[model samples]
Target: MVIEWLTLMVPADWHERFIAADTAIWTHFLAQQPGYVGKQIWRNPAKPDELTLLIHWQSRQQWKAIAPTALAAVEQEFRQNLGRSFDIIAANEYQPLADGSISSQRPMAD
Candidate 1:
């Protein structure tokens, strides 16, 4: 699996609005795309303005296969829905190591 990590800055007061619009726009659009597995949104109490998004994909190729034009359109829709632009603090991609830690039978939590 490939994981897309994005850290964004959205004012605390706009957290709810951001989540609502993101779920309605980006999440929905991603779900319809090939290789999309799932996504999660997270926040830290100490960093109320920061939002972290974890997007899972079946493979790096599949994730990168999304056309630039399609991505631009979705981003435009997202901005329009939120009525503002968000700052992306960081973005990164990760893939599971060859070691079987992730895929092993051992549970991550008891």
Candidate 2:
């Protein structure tokens, strides 16, 4: 399985709004994507703007095949609806460990 990780930083003052937006994205947007196994969102207390997303996929090829269409829809949500509220960082795709543990031992692509 492959996991797609995305980190987003939103203005501290817009935290509530961003959270609500993420709810919509996850439920309305991501839930409909093909090969989407599951996802989790994390909040960083130390850095109010920090948001982390972990998305599970059946395979890299499946993700790649549907990403263009899936991301375009998401991009519209970010740019048209929530653009002014946050800064988006790039996403990282990693090959999960055989044991299904997200430990430091998980190999990251170079």
Best by TM-score: 1
Clashing residue pairs found in predicted model 2: none
Candidate 2 lDDT over residue span 2-109, tens digit each: 999888886677777776777777546766767878888787899777888888889888778866766776867765676664566868998866665567365779
Worst 10 residues of 1 by lDDT: 99-108
lDDT of 1 at 86: 96
Q: Which stretches in model 2 have alpha-carbon errors above 4 Å?
A: 67-70, 83-85, 100-110
For all candidates in order, the CA lDDT equals 0.93, 0.75
Q: Candidate 2 — worst ten consecutive residues by lDDT sum?
A: 97-106
Clashes of 1: 0
| Candidate 1 whole-model C-alpha lDDT, 0 to 1 | 0.93
